[model samples]
Target: MFNRKHLEAILITRTELRLPRTTPEAVGIRSTAIAALLDAWKESGLELHSMMILRHGQVAAEGWWAPYAPELSHMLFSLSKSFTSSAIGLAAAEGLLSLDDAVISFFPEVAPEEPSANLSAMRVRHLLMMGTGHEEDTMGPLSSAEDGDWVRAFLQVPVGREPGTHFVYNSGATYMLSAILQKVSGVKLLDYLRPRLLDPLGITEGTWESCPRGIHTGGWGLMLTTESIAKFGQLYLQRGVWEGKRILSEEWVNEATSKQIHNGDDEANDWTQGYGYQFWRCRNGAYRGDGAFGQFCIVLPEKDTVIALTSGTNDMQGVLNGIWTHLLPALTEDVTADPAAHEALSDKLGSLTLEPPVLDAASPLESEVSGSRYVLDENQFQWTALSVQFESQEAVVTLENCEGEFVLRCGRGEWAEGRGVLLQGAPFQRGANHRMASSFTWRDSETLSITLRYIETPFYVTSELKFNGDELTAQQQVNVAFFSPELPSLHGRRS
Candidate 1:
């Protein structure tokens, strides 16, 4: 849990001068490039979805693509590592542990009876720097182990290079931090960070998934509103102070954001910016936290700016180059608003909203099956829902299809209440690739469906919901093969 006094400290505190959206840019940005960037972003097909720009602590520019909204919590991907690193700093401040401490100190039992030089020499700092010397462990192979053996599994991996001598982009290393933080702090990462970070920033609630070991996945599984990521960038922009509270020490910020390793030196990667604790350096002096597809919170000290972005996969290099070639040039020390142009630009920024997912026109079948019923239409093409309750004004559904089962409550969109499930396997703590893009399209009154489409493999899946009261049926289909394998469609209409 978050420290109570810290939570109380910021609860009623107020800022003397609230930050404004736009700083007085003496030679303000060129209004023309703003539209140009948007066009280029879309034309490039980089799956660029939402953007928020803060200049001098105000929302200088912000916008979201259709379907994507400011309110939705986006996957941070690798960007989550930065938060993990920040938590390390916070824990250090609280005297929970120090980065310099030996990682084995937290898990003394994980070391082998006779450890290798690298294994014995490994420290917590190396893990933060992606220099853990693990030969090869990706996509959470460590997670498959018994919860208690996870750390041991990681430690047992042979060191390909000396600890702290090589820079390997390792998500597994970050997971260990999540595990170790829990071990040392005696609290889960999100809950521990709530008052210390979230509550202070006004993020009242969010869901962060835990690994099989039940530790918050430090390297991934963090979901935050696009705006919240912007706030984090803002906090870093102010060097870790928010609304007058010193959240993190300056020393931690300097070390974490500074280039700790040249990660992509041989790989010829976009992280051309270099790697810090969990942050990647940008072309200029800016640093950012990024995820798969596209989730970014780029902070530039020289420009006194922060840009928070969420996106789907298309092209990452294009996104970075677009920002640099277009947006960066516009960031002048003196930016005077073209009143005529400013209105349009303001209209452009912070504009766009998702239309409510509405049920389509009713049909004869829809009226007939308005309540619920047991559906065992196809054996392999099977769908069954449990707890298929219907309120006068709502639809409650919990269903399992070939792909997976999700419990959705929608008073508004697809779900009967506030919950929802994607036709694809839900987002997992393993990595960024696990994210699913589920969009809803109501087929008829009796059937509402969502498609779980992946940017990569395991793509193109559809889930159809058939409604009745005590019995409900759903169908899941993958657009992969001409003939998908027959599945034994389990049948049990949830009462």
Candidate 2:
């Protein structure tokens, strides 16, 4: 049934029905409203990478910050959960599985000995709703176990309360959903959706990171371009029908997006509004699939619009707040044409860029530190040796660590792109293809500072190297960290 000819046919149909492009005024949205949203984002200190606004199934505005282009597939983090949930929906439609099925039924071999009553009552729907009954998140312990058998480890965890009685933001539960889908379908989550969802949607460049056992990481690690995310939202907005064909059953879409449980009592908090199957309901009668660091796919049925964005900011709520304040009120029922506003908004979107690090004249200290090897005492980073070489416009820094010799070329003021692996420290490890944009500046006559930004991820590291006569000290700090608020500084001395 999964043949090349069928996949090609689906792709052709998707291209024929590709989302139309139009001016904001052609839709009911005012161009000035989008401009105001951008202004609000900047004022909120949010670092935006890319965004696309759609109205009436047509793209009204889309742009990417310089260095982060529209073609690049950004890491979606937990936004991947929405796609995984879709895969389960497809499997159910095919009669391969049912939402009421006991999760343990799919993995008899991994089932715990004498499963607890709570575990026994756990259903697939419970996993979908984050109602696993575990008081706290189980991903930490389940992922850290040495055996690397995530299924077995998760099953062994004590289900403290009856299934569906409570809600905990459990990523492991989503992972279990992926594992169950794979168990029944005999394929990974991504593969299962390739022909059924992605091909039909014309998303050709989707990828998902796999665990040690080669299973797709359902709760995280999916990558897609901004337009692809917008397409997914548009599909859900159309009630699972793309063009004339029904890609997903309308019944499934309604159930998946409807609030399944009460997540919190605070009505003021957006996250407390409600939660569906891997979808978060908003106060304005909308829902979204979002990830860490502000990756969002918002579906606004009331406005006949969808907004997709990828960002590297800690204040995710701030992004949503900007949307509600700036974009929500602008969605009118009738198109309002303002050529001046459209031109201004177009110019601003075309010129969007992240500010580069400041550059200053080379210091006299450069002559003293040029090609100097710094030998260090024991430090938290375990960096053994370091060297710096000054060039006309950039500095080349080399360091020896447990992983081996690593080199980074830092631009004087601009962002210089380089590929390498950033060691695991703050939260998680990245792939070798990870790209970092680096900049260097002389903080003073005696101090040199360098900033390395993993553009694909949210965090950035700032290193300060201070020189006092022949002695040198190095300190590293993270702008925002996941596991810890503050990281220990590494100390070193020049030999």
Candidate 3:
């Protein structure tokens, strides 16, 4: 368990203003190109939350979709692997550990009594490069370990191949990196990088979820603003020097981002390009640290650009395709500003919004269901009862579940702020305060539809409540999920 003082010390606030904001045209990218990019993404139905483009060390164009504000930090998912790699690089530079160190050496007590030859030879570098030699991903066993000893569980997994000879996208290996960093440095991954990396970058608000043992889950569960991601990409682009100070050795930067392993042979697929130290090589002489559901921090050395994006879509490749198709080819050194195009781009950015439901007109059933309570039957959520109170422009929904009763608000034709938990019984840890932005619409005369977006993570649930006289039927479906997106329908009676 983490000490309270140490957990509290994970937070440190200081703003270092260095990334100057500028127009796309000033940076050699046409403003009309950016406007077109947004239009194309919208046309493709890609649920992008925010985007930040940096060229020549300056922010060229940045915008956040409605309800995804600049201040809000987004979940990084596997992109957290890149940050964990950075911490490992720092630890190596400090001489606390070496990449050549054997993985079992860090946790000698938990290591197998008689390790296999492949497991014994597994080195720290193998973990960074996704070359741990395990035939399959070890994440499944690591997560479901009943004993809660992740280190032991990981070590017990059979290493089927020689270390550094193969590649499997094993998230558990990244977790071991975090466990090693904490074991050697006696601090969490975020805390260890605070002074060396985060402070210099002016990343004040960030959090990394921890494992059962209180070690930071290095493979995922990191949250930071879009600007922070941009700064990190810029730092890597600048060869680990931040504001003229060398935060990381130039040698480490080269090694970490360079192609370290062969992942696949499909030249057309971006993911098949190559794998680095927790980074992925891109098609256009670029490298990136990306996450599930389309979170990205792409660094283009050839173009001298960095593009950061947060999105909620299953089509991760589609998001990258939009960047390559629209934003990349137009990046030139020639400066030519189209005033009219710039004005249009600015207006487009300012007015960018996710359209709320169109069928928001007041329903005939609104008066009949207003302030009425429904006692739901047996369900997975343990939601015993639900009530909706309608107002002129919003509807207040209250639900009583196993956790307790909670209230949420859905705007009639816009997004309204609210709070609720998601995937409560799931394996991952839930934040103490999970926020939501809900929009409600009358799908028909008898059905009330609501879209609840968990703002911090890439998840949105569409719930439909159908009222038929003395009974009600409710169904919920998520936009994207690892498992089934549709949940079992629920029936209830007016109480």
Give the candidate number with the greatest lDDT.
3
The total number of steric clashes, by the backbone 3 Å criterion, in model 1 comes to: 29
- The residue-by-residue lDDT of candidate 2 on 1-495, one tens digit each, is 112222122132445535688999999899999999999999988989999999999999988776566656788989999999999999999999999999888888989868999999999999999999998888887779798888888898899999898889999999998999898999999999999999888888888877778889799989888888999999999999997889999999999999998899887677988789999988799999999889999999999999999998889889999999999999997866899999999999887777556755478999888888888777666778888999988899998877788898988877777877775466545544676778888888888889887766666788888988778777777776565645666556667
TM-score winner = 3
Q: Model 3, residue 314: displacement in angstroms?
A: 0.9
How far off is model 1, as Cα RMSD?
7.7
Error of 1 at 7 (Å): 30
Q: Kindly report which residue pairs in candidate 3 clash with one another.
A: none
Worst 10 residues of 1 by lDDT: 1-10
User: Any residue pairs clashing in model 2, and if so which?
Assistant: none
Which stretch of 10 consecutive residues in model 2 shows the poorest summed lDDT? 1-10
Q: What does candidate 3's lDDT look like per residue over 1-495, in tens digits?
A: 112233123233433454788888888999878888899999999999999999999998888777777777899999999999999999999999999999999999999999999999999999999999999889899889998889999999999999999999999999999999999999999999899899888887789988888999999999998889999999999999988899999999999999999999987789989899999999989899999899999999999999999998999988888888888888999968788998888888766667677695689788889999999998877789999999998999998887688898888888887666774533234545876788899889999999888878888888899999989999888887778888778799999
Q: Candidate 3: what lDDT?
A: 0.88
How would you encode candidate 1's per-residue C-alpha lDDT over 1-495 as one tens digit per residue?
112233113232344322345622333566666767876886775656677778778876667654344445666677788888888889988998888887777887667787777777888888888888776654456766665466677776677778888777888899888888898888998888888987787765456767666788788778776677888899898988988999988888888999887766533345765778888887778888888667789998998878888776546677887888888888886655577676766666534432334555233554444445354544532444343444444444555565566554444242211323333233322234333334454687667665443322222345676665545555665543324522223344533
Clash count of each predicted structure: 29, 0, 0
Better of 1 and 3 by lDDT: 3
Error of 3 at 229 (Å): 0.3
Candidate 2 off by > 4 Å = 1-19, 359-361, 378-382, 402-404
Q: In candidate 1, residue 268 scores what lDDT?
A: 37
